[model samples]
Target: MGMNAASVLNHIINGEPTTPCSSKGATSSQAKALTTTIINHLRLGRLGKAVSVLFSAPVPFPFALYVHLFRICASKKAIVEVRKVESHLVSFAPTPPVFLLNRAIEAYGKCGCLVDARELFDEMPQRDGGSWNAMVTAYSQNGYAGKALGVFSDMHKSGIFAAEVTFASVLASCASILALWLSRQVHALVFKYGFGGNVILGSSLVDVYGKCRRMGDARRMFDEIERPNAVTWNVIIRRYLEMGNGKESVFLFFKMISLNVRPLTFTVSNALVACSSFRGFREVIQIHGLIIKISYEEDEVVSCSLIDVYAKCGDLVCARTIFDLLSPKNLIHWTSMVSGYTLSGKTRLARELFDRMPERSIVSWNAMLAGYAHSSQWDEAMELIILICNDMRNTDRVTVSLILNVSAGLSDLELGKQVHGYMYRHGFYSDLSVANALLDMYGKCGNLRKARAWFYEMRHFRDMVSWNALLSSYARHRMSEEALVIFWEMQQEATPSKFTFATLLAVCANIFAREQGKQIHGFLIRNGYDLDIVIRGALVDMYSKCRCLDYALNVFIGTSVKDVVLWNSLMLGCYYNKQSEAILKLFELMKEDGVKPDSTTFQAVLLACISQGCVKLGGQYFNSLSQDYFIIPQVEHYESMIKLYGLHGFFDELEDFVEKMPFQPTAPMLARVFDSSKEYNNTRLGKWAVRHLSFLKD
Candidate 1:
């Protein structure tokens, strides 16, 4: 095909003027053929020959010649050849026109050769905002936010009136930089320039606020707009999901749908995330159905999001089904499914799928490690950490955090120390997240001394997790005073979270610190954190343990909502106060309210029975434990049984049961029953107690 076309071109070029027999018509035909050949060469990117043919041929070249060459250089990012074509244009019989300069600017911009593009824009004696917009766009595309802003400023200073494209480019810069203040300034300029209502500008404003974590502002802008495009809806909805307002995000989706705004692939993906965050299977299915209805169900982004949504919401089977159907699975799709299994505590299945993956990313490894850590499978988590440590490609702060978390659950002080050494050797000890995890691990593993050392060593700026870890450590070690001190420090320096109040409440419960507990309660109510269940439960348990039963009761009754654990706290408080009637009433109330009693409830009830010598009720409840509640009697139940039996003069039965029991009685149980023989004999209860105590003591 090439040879035929080239021969036709040669014949036309050589025969054009020599024949002279009405050769004007022949020459026209030859010129047309030569131009066709040159176009084909340029299209094929045979640049040398195309340039030669253009320069050597008698046929005149069109503007298409330079434009084609510019495209090839831009696509290949061949800056040298692009400049060559420009220089050749200058030597042309007439200089290339303004239209040609624009093509060159676009090419340079696309190729990230902004310096050259800027030079060209400056060299132009006559300029327009379009030319300046091109330069600003080049800077924005290349991640040069500062340069983009500077160019935008110059464009304004030169009195080049801003156009929609100009504002759009500047907004891109602000969004990249997360410069909300600058973005607002740009919005004002857009309004000043009569481009405020532009769909493109409105979308950029929504995006800017979302990036700045100002979702409310973004929503306000979205609502203020009379009409919003799909991009506007997508940006706001995505922000809602990121902010953990999944319900609001879904509401926005419904609103968008009501307006008949069609969703794109991005919209479907975001809606799927909202579904996952809410963990509403029905809503997820609804979104999935909508995706299918919109014909984006099979799209790569949408399908990946579907797998993620289902996996996050614990629909692993559906996630796996979707994974099997995707023809070409990427890393993200595989990672999502693996993360789902890991998070759901199905580590074995997650590991199986992880190994089956054709390839893995660092995120996949992190997911597997985190799964093991979360499920308390410490050995496996540590093994993966060792593997990651040995492998040069996989080591990172996230991996270290996973391993540290596992160590925290195991409370293996020795292994935690080893991880600290490894972190130091790798120069990762200074990484705040890694350091925080290490501090948390040491705290959880009961090495509060070492945890405190690491805490003080951390850079002065502390995050919530840092403070929470330290406070939790002190609480676990019964150092309530120190924990309270740190908590107040946290409140003074930073905003306290539910974890902060919860940890402090735990300390108060441990030491029965009533004054401190009330202070935290006041803080909770003042901060509007009283309704947070974790914090509320902590306060209830603290007040109960501190012997402030009246206050505890008020808080407990005031809250209309209560879970099983909350009821358990109240019942335990009654047991501690020796208020047997209150314990029974609370248990009946719990049952009436449909809150199932747990092991703690059984413990509290048994203690109440032992306190009052309610043998008939104790035996009945003990039998109910095994038959109705399916609770195999633990050591505490046996201790309570022995006490009840000893109190009721069932000496032989207690003695025989103690002899055949699976474990030894605790020190307190022995002291309470056997060491009281003097008082027992004085009270005429000697014979019964001696019979049970003789065999166990011997």
Candidate 2:
């Protein structure tokens, strides 16, 4: 057979004429022999020889020979070979049968030759469902998701008979685009086309739902997939992890294990991540053991993930141990270790390691830069930025943003301007995130004119963060009217987020504009903001500052999860309104409700005590600072205590309290003692205060 392959090619393809049996071309013994030899060479892994013998055929090759050639080239993803076969096939048959042309289209698509695939498909006199499927699959697999969807639209208009593969490719496109609404519609079409029971197609449906965040629907589709494979299990588990349901994600991981399904390495990485987010050290330890048992500990991707989760769990020792064991020490492991050290504030050692890296990616450079930025090593960070700008490799937006952060930290408007120029020169200013960072840097570094210039320059590209950055800048400068006008303009374009409303309320609070505060609060509620703890605390603080104590208290009472901030806000409101008795009662309620008191909480409590002249009660609460709650008394707490004793005419106790305090009495404390001495006619204590104040400046 091998000899025949060599001999058959020399007869026809080597400048020898083919024997034409009829208009249908050769069907004689010679053509059959040529086709056989070509298949034999292809089967023997001699693709070059097969093509040689194919072109050297003594007659026009049969259609079946071309089918085999297309199938082989497609399987290997051999774009060069597919192109050769295509040119030869087209030169002979300008209008081949649709099925044969369809095969050629599919071969091109599989090789990621989308342009060639589309060209071949367009020139076809007719197309079946396979032709459309081939084009969609080409775009879908090449990550041209929008293009795939566009071609699928054309497919629908052509009224071609769609096949199972066509829907499958289209479904994949929807998944890539995260078009959840469209995914649901395609899912309905799946059942209507009677492909509901096909497990492969069913898994695609599951993947679509999972990536789109419909975990419940993803799980249901997964369960219906008979004999669910590794991919099926991975889809739901990863989605749950993405949704931040770490417990459920880990639970699914265990369930998959119990069913005797071996988790893929990808699945193990996600499970390790979930363990970091919600589980304990022991669970991560178990995953480490599983990795060793499965022999995946050496896999770089899984190893990197284990290192990240270990670092996140505050076990950098173990993370470093795993990082050291990797043989090749690729960029990922290097970046992960540097990031881990930077996060843990071991910047000196991180820099040492970063300096020794064999190679560097943008992420590696960013990790090092971030370490310097986080540790506030301004000299090293600034120097590194200069080095990065001079390097041959390109720095991405993250690098530029971190550099901007360093400039903002130093409040160096000159350095920031240089970076802005770098951005404009390199074309990164077009990216919205890069533009947003520049705007924030300008605002922070005291270059408001430049900030607004860049902001208005990118008006067409502004997202919510863009508007918020500008609004926050105005708020920071106390440009109340300007901020209000910006907010109104923002409402016409983008919906206000919780942060947006919070900034507006802060603006109102600063000016004590009660009406504007109420208007913002109304807009906040009307827009259905979730009123998370941050927003709720902001609202309470705003209302209280606006002198609406009743409204502030209403916000406090309506909240089900009253954190310490809420209690403190209400208590401070009471102190502001001179509701000393109510402040005392709320303090008791806060303790009873098990809300631990911080320094701010006790300040409000002590201030209320001083207002009411309750010296003994104030003393007991002061003792509770170290006794029960372990909160160290700040200077304000000591000042409040002196006022409490002095206003109530307790002269001797005031003198003793000041003398036995952990430190020497502040001038303010001694002065309060002097006032109480004059009011109560205690000349002896007045003399003692005068002695202390003789040399101490108030």
Candidate 3:
């Protein structure tokens, strides 16, 4: 053979050899040749043959051979070969060198055998900085941040001067735990060691500060960087966006662009998120143009952000166009499209897309369930909830919250109780949103006692929504005194939202409590809530119902933006106040304001005509309901029509209207006809009304 041990080791280290193998069962010379062959095999990446040749060797190999094998095994993270080499090293000598021990420690740590690594580290008689660094890096890499920090402290106390790598690893551990003070101490050490100018170190510092919500400090550190890379800018922008300063983030993005810095996919994604915050349609479009300019339109994350922003802006057409054009629709993109459709009130399209999805995530299912709940499709929502509970192994809190909302909408107390039980069994009863939804469900279903019990039981979990839910329950039931008491209690516990005030005003309106309503109005004016459209509508209705037409008119005229609902509210108030002429005049003014009349508007105007006994005017408005505004008459509209005919003693017309009514004549309709007959002393009409009433009861 041409190879000696030195040359063979050199060849193994170089991953190549010049010699061929000899036969097995050989002399010492032949064993040497075979050992060269095994090294050569190992060098060629044939691990199995090398191990086989090593085990089948006639005698134990030289110490150099085992050392080289150990080095190779450690590098490859071959734990079995490492252990085998360790066994050979142990039998060959009483003690292994520090270098071999360090390699073994590192190999074990890299292979996630931390216990073995720690054992070897502790068994060593002496160690170097490399030993400590490997352990620290291992602990940090494996999510033991606090342990890594403790090890670093021990290394410092052991008189090992920390290197740049050591400081870097420690800084990473500190950042992971959000140890702001410790990170600051590390920063001081970095400058003391003159590594403060290092770009990687600076980036880590910025990240730590950003995560700790010290944006000002993060910005200052970022400015100190000589040439911040794309990642640096991305970090600062993301930090700003996370801190809810979208405008600042967008401005910084433009500044980065002005400096000719290339934007990455994350940069564009973050910028799109910033655009979504302000609903700046112009900025969103401009950023989209930039995305197209940079050829990131095809990127999945960027595309998803664009879809999300468009959906939030209520531009479902654009959102759908983007979604349709995506080639390979991922789960996230599919979920976004479903959510967009649901938000736009296109439940049918959402359901179709949901059914067609190749795979469904919990989020996708939750989106569809929430859509049904929001649209008041309680049956469909309940069906999907049952399917999810049975088919899916786990469900999140959002799913439970949505189902609870459906139960509330349907006022199905039994179903709500069942869901409550399911939540208790599934460990979701502690979720505040679920609790609030349960309270709302019970309240809406007329179980205020249960609602009150649940509310009081939520000692710490009660948030603003919980208080408002209970308050709205009282308001809805016209428990005026109880609502006022809850209102005051809520004011002491949590700040009342506009919704709370709106509910309270509704309670006042129902009970015709003028003093309480005026006090609330005063509070509204003092608190600058007088201009909220909901509060304004509630006030107009309350005052008009209280027979204070002048006060209601002032509030109505003071309203700058009079939607059809507000006009209808005022007109209805006038009807209730017996100002029938004012109702017609308000209708003319509404037409002048170009506010399209809804069914409520038509109902209010028709009610006014009935109050004044103006049959012709009421009939004209009823005709216009379909002809002028194209609003199909609802049940309320038909009821008003019957009342108009009955009040005017149009017995022939009233009977004809009853026969031609689109729906079966309800009890109120028969009562109206009967009362009209008694007023006019018409016994025949009364008998006809009596027959219809009897038929309806049967």
Candidate 4:
């Protein structure tokens, strides 16, 4: 068996030649014996020796032998062996068959060597449907959807008609690039080829529509599959899960069960993930119970999803119970448990558990690091980041993205630049999410130059998030001209989301651009983005800050449901416009609407009280701050009361209020009081303020 094949494996490792690839004058029976020996070695998992024996053999292998080796290597994804076998067949095997060339193409594709696969396909003097399908599958499997479609086009023009497998492979390519238009074209071809009744082909059509997010078309095709098997059921179920319709996905899962289709490991895991997506605690429990009854809980993937769902639903006790029960734990189990604790905000326990793990992946590290970010423990996060940067074996795009976000949260621009350097070094800069995170970090840290550079670099592949990220950067720094210009450019390519309008509204408010704000408002109505509360509130805020209190009030009145933030915005608008009476009236209307007032709501109310010199009314509201509303008075609340008292010359109330403050008066409070006393020619209160100020300075 050449058990010591690893010893001579240096023949391939160091680019040395093996024995002759041919044994001249060898009999067919002898060749068959050698082929059986090599296959026996391959079946025993002695791939090194099998390859060693393959290239070392005296006899050239049969075409069938080459097929076997290539098939096995394709399954094992042994690229080195694949190249070795490919070279041998091309050099020694005179007049290789197209089917063998097709096998070689399939092998290279499975090895993620699409370049070699395509090159081999191109060199084939003749091809059948298999050759073109193999090339299309090679490209599609390796994430080259455009290339796959290109080969399919050539296949069509070459007069080699598409088989059912060709359409299935082409649909997969369509799904990958989300090419809905091309997918529709392919769907017409599927029927033109008269494979419409094929269940698996129909499922592939469903996949193309599903991934394109045209779920209505997906469902239409899905229902056309009259006798849907497990694969078909899984396709629809998984697509719904991907689309984040957890309830629908779970319903399909139950429907599959009712139809007596026993879900496999993949089906159970997908169903569990669906349950977790919407935090369906009751569904999760039912699924968990079902899995336990079927002994499917013992499956590692199902167990991992169970832990994740339970942790996400805030049942850490149940999650830990599952985690502790697993035997011979692997990295997935450990990472899942750590992520559970992190998601639950128990970073300390997460860290302790993480330290105890025998091995760690970038995912576990990311989960722990994200906990620090969530808790705002930037210092601890930076220290963990140092450890991560040192041990970067598993560092991926996720790692780069997480570290960039942490740097942003810390507001450490230097650290962010270092991470940017690391990303460039590690080839993560091209990852869209990582690049967007880098852009966001630079923007948040007030480094416009770096953000703009990344924005330009990302333009070709940029999505809505990338455009919004750059827009947010401009808005944050009040680069009004740049924001407006970039938004106009964004509209030509990416559509603005609700949050995009929110950020734009902030830009409008910051620059007091009333006309621009009006346009955005009209755009919202025209585009049907007016329903979002946050966007509507942004519209109110934009008009309010532009001194158009009337427009702000109209938006506030038009919104069917008003949150406290919206009420505060309108009230603050009145206060800014010197319509102090209107602010008080809005507060009463807010109460009548039964919207609970938060701290900011009262701040606006108190500012209005100060404006009108409503001494008695202000006093009653100030008392009601804690008595009736139970809103604990903050320092700003106390300062507002002092200003109200001192402004109207209520000296007794002012003195008593200052004395009754629970904490020492802030400097602003004292400064305002002393200034008011001086203006009113009150020597006693002025003297009292000066004494307190001196003592506070001491």
Alpha-carbon TM-score of each model against the true structure: 0.81, 0.78, 0.72, 0.79
Candidate 2 ranges beyond 4 A from true positions = 1-81, 92-103, 125-132, 144-163, 178-189, 212-216, 276-286, 325-328, 344-358, 371-380, 390-392, 578-592, 602-698
lDDT of 4 by residue, 1-698 (tens): 36554333322233212222444445444555666667668658898778777676645566656776788799999999998888878776667778889999999999999889978887888889999999999988888889999999988988899999888889998898889999999899889989989998999988889988989999999999888889888989989998889889999998998898878878888988888788888888888888988898778888998899899899999999999999978899999999999988999989999999998878888889988888888889989988997986668787788888888888999989998888888788888899899999999999999898888988788899998998999998889879999999999998899988899999999999999999988898898765568987888888989999889888888999899989888888888778888988999999999998988888898899899888898888888889988989988889899999999999999999999989988778889999999999999999989888999899
Candidate 2 TM-score to native:
0.78
Ranking of models by TM-score: 1, 4, 2, 3
lDDT of 2 by residue, 1-698 (tens): 46764564444333223332335423455666776687668758988788777665535666666776888799999888888777777666555678878888888888888889989888887777877888888889889998988888888787766778888888899998899988888788778878888877888888888888888899899888878778778878888888999888888888888888899999999999999887467888988998898899989879999888988888889999998889988999999999988888888888888988898888998998999998989889999888887773788889988988899888998988888899989999898888898898888877778888888998898999988998888888888778889999998989888899888888888888899999888877787779887788888888888889999988888898999988998888887777878988998899899888898988898888888888898999888998988888999888988888889987777777888799988788888889889899999998988889986863
User: Residue 419 of model 3: what lDDT?
Assistant: 86
RMSD of each: 6.4, 6.2, 7.1, 6.6
Please give the TM-score that candidate 3 achieves against the real structure. 0.72
Backbone clash count for every predicted candidate, in the order shown: 0, 1, 0, 1
lDDT of 2: 0.84
Clashing pairs in 2: 13-56
On lDDT, the candidate that comes out on top is: 4
The lDDT of model 1 is: 0.78
Q: Please, what are the lDDT tens digits per residue for candidate 1 over residues 1-698?
A: 47855564454445433222233666567656766777678558686676566556554444555666677678878776667666666554244467678778878888888888988888876666677887888888889999999989888887889888878888889989899888888888888888767888888888888888988788888887889988889988888888889889888898898899998788888888888777878888887888878788668888888887888888889999988888788888888889888878999999998889887778888989888888888888878877766754647888877778887887777877888998989888988899899998998888888888888888475688888889888888888898888887877767888888888888888888899889878877887865666666777788888988888888888878788788888888877777876777788888899877777788788888877778778878877887988878887788788788777666566666666777765555655556443434434334444555566777
**Comparing 2 and 4 by lDDT, which wins?**
4
lDDT of 3 by residue, 564-668 (tens): 878988998988877888988989999999888899998888888888898888988998988987888898988898899888888888887788877888888
